[model samples]
Target: MALDALGSPAAARDGMLDVTRDGRPSARIHVTSRGGEGRALVLVHGAGVDGSFFGGLASAFAGRRVVTYDRRGCGVSSDALDGDWSLDAQAADLAAIIRKAGAPADVVAHSLGSLVAMRALELAPGLMRRLVLIEPPLFVGLDPADPVFQNLVRAGQALAKGHTSTLFMLALERENMGDAIRPFTQDELAFRERDVQTHADHEAGWMLAYKPDLARIRAQGVPVLLCMSERSASTYHARNQDFLARGMGADLMRLPGGHNAPRDYPDEVATRLSTWL
Candidate 1:
């Protein structure tokens, strides 16, 4: 099933691509491709979201081959984790996807997805021509004593202790989006529930523990466009993006709307992406 411009199901080209790592079967990823020309641009979604999250954004790139896929267990991708689900594993999955979609692709990754793309770039150099990272949550450089960071850590701990994923995600949205938070439709809620069951635990645990190899990424010299939302309520993400921009020597672009700008402001995001990519 292909997703429409608003991320709803519609008729379009879709396929299931098998991803492998170290000569072993890794995942059977559900991929959707659209548009006409230019370098293949892949959209990598963040935690608790799937390829459908980029449906609207994907439609905006009219002339570029835009590929969006459900990352491993998210959406319709294979859910058999086989007890090995970490950021590194996700990065490998991404590398395989990039190779299948067309190597030297341009990537636009959001939130935790940015981390996965960065890791993939480090692991598979020259696979990506350009990268656009949107608000990666890197708490490594932040002061642990800060109240905002403390709250975020506590929320993760709650999830680790079996706190309700719905409530956890609601709290997260409130924190990040503040008054801009909107009600999720029934389908959106269902997707969120499935994603939470599949990835929330790992996201709260090992994913948070994973750190990027900034030095290796810098050495590769892949052009990066770091994006942050103008109305994001969280200081954690803003500070982290600033740190990342400086560390990677990336060109930073500020877009309107909250952290989920692709959903809320697809036109603006696409315009900026077209200019950058």
Candidate 2:
């Protein structure tokens, strides 16, 4: 497999697949695959970004097939939102991708993507063999009065009050990711900017209201690894990861860098993933 100048898988290996829900054509997901042998390792991205968000990290899984796809309404995937932004629908999309990649694949999901992956595992047990959840914003587990939670609510409210999605997304990245976004290239930043509306309009509220089915996930008996960035360990994201690690009986990994560690410090994240998986 070839890598681009940025160390991401080149566009020559890109593919497209249609995701169906209830036997109806739902989304046209853009997928990128590379590497060979071993079980497929699927990369699921979070909000405000697309599958390319994992470009830096996906190429590091030596000998294992790595797959990454743009979620509906984000990246090069279907732009039609309709009712597809719901958590169930997003999970269904993930399930379809896992099935296409061959069942029993391992998954590495970041932020909101982690929630979708967990829900997918619950909805269709045994589709994924191992799970790595990276700093998922499981807000339900956090204190309602916490400053971060309160600020998130305010951000949403501001969006409802007529803030531009781009501005909202910029604020969000600054707040949650801080200087982590600085290491990303200009093209990467533009890619995320384009999908701000999809997140600000359709996904943010749903993410805030989502309640993880921890019992079902725990019952699945799938081995899970919870990853938290060193910088984020002092924020609400770390709290959420800590809560999930305990609830799901998952092994905790402390990686270098901030929330966007996979992008800023891909080799380090990949090294840990290789060891964990």
Candidate 3:
């Protein structure tokens, strides 16, 4: 990747850093760093998306160096996502991003990225000085026997048959997210198509692996900010929000828009983040 500076002096410089384990390539994370002297701020995007999703939060953190990266298989990174994609592997990738950012950084993650960030904290707690999770779907306060799980299972089955649009809409309906996602622009829909299956793969593995025993981690261990959307449709997401705030003693943040608040209301979310931090 070219180390060419961005058009603006303050624009982040894009690069690719290899995150390896046992001297083998684990992942090639695509990163953008707005270099600064202070501790870095790393933003991890959610499922079916990449770091560009954090474009809204960029200027809000101008004074400090902020970094963003694509998770494995989601964007321009390596899709070495065969077999079971355990949360451990994803978390290790996150930790590597932190170390590449010069370590000891503040982390802000959204959706599935929240799960990765939390596990990263557990893997290398010292890398995070502060953490923020936005509408994490940890499935707390959810019954294992609920039909929703079966619906989700069926959705995955549909994905295996190369039916993306229907599977996606079904997921939105199940979350009560409505038809707002319909009428996608050509480019937006293309991006989603590339992302949805990788997301499904990760979700499948996450279900089989992580136990969602979030209470095992405590608020006292690290400073945490728990953010939620005032309009998020998923009841399970809300449950996780409340559970994390109460159990982790996290600072509660209610933002505009729904589960993908950062993407929907970039300016508002960025402004709030600036004010809070």
Model 2 C-alpha lDDT per residue in residues 42-114, reported as the tens digit of each score: 8999888888778778766666678888888888778643456688888888887777777899999998898
> For every model in order, what is the number of clashing pairs?
0, 0, 0
Cα RMSD (angstroms) for every candidate in the order listed: 4.3, 4.4, 4.0
Please give, for residues 1-277, the per-residue lDDT of candidate 1 as tens digits.
3223212233246777766666777777778878665567889998887887887788887777788888878888886445557777888888877776668889999987888898898888989999999988777767788776676677667766777554365336534542334444453455776776676655556556767777788889799998888876466787577677778889988887888888777777899879989
Which is the leading candidate under lDDT? 2
For model 3, residues 20-100, the per-residue Cα lDDT tens digits are 776677777777777554677888888777776676566456576778877887666777634335788888888887876
Winner by lDDT between candidate 3 and candidate 1: 1
Residue 157's lDDT within candidate 1 is 70
Question: Deviation in angstroms for 231 in model 3?
Answer: 0.7
Ordered list by TM-score, greatest first: 1, 2, 3
* lDDT at residue 55 of model 3 (Cα atoms): 65
lDDT, each prediction:
0.75, 0.77, 0.69
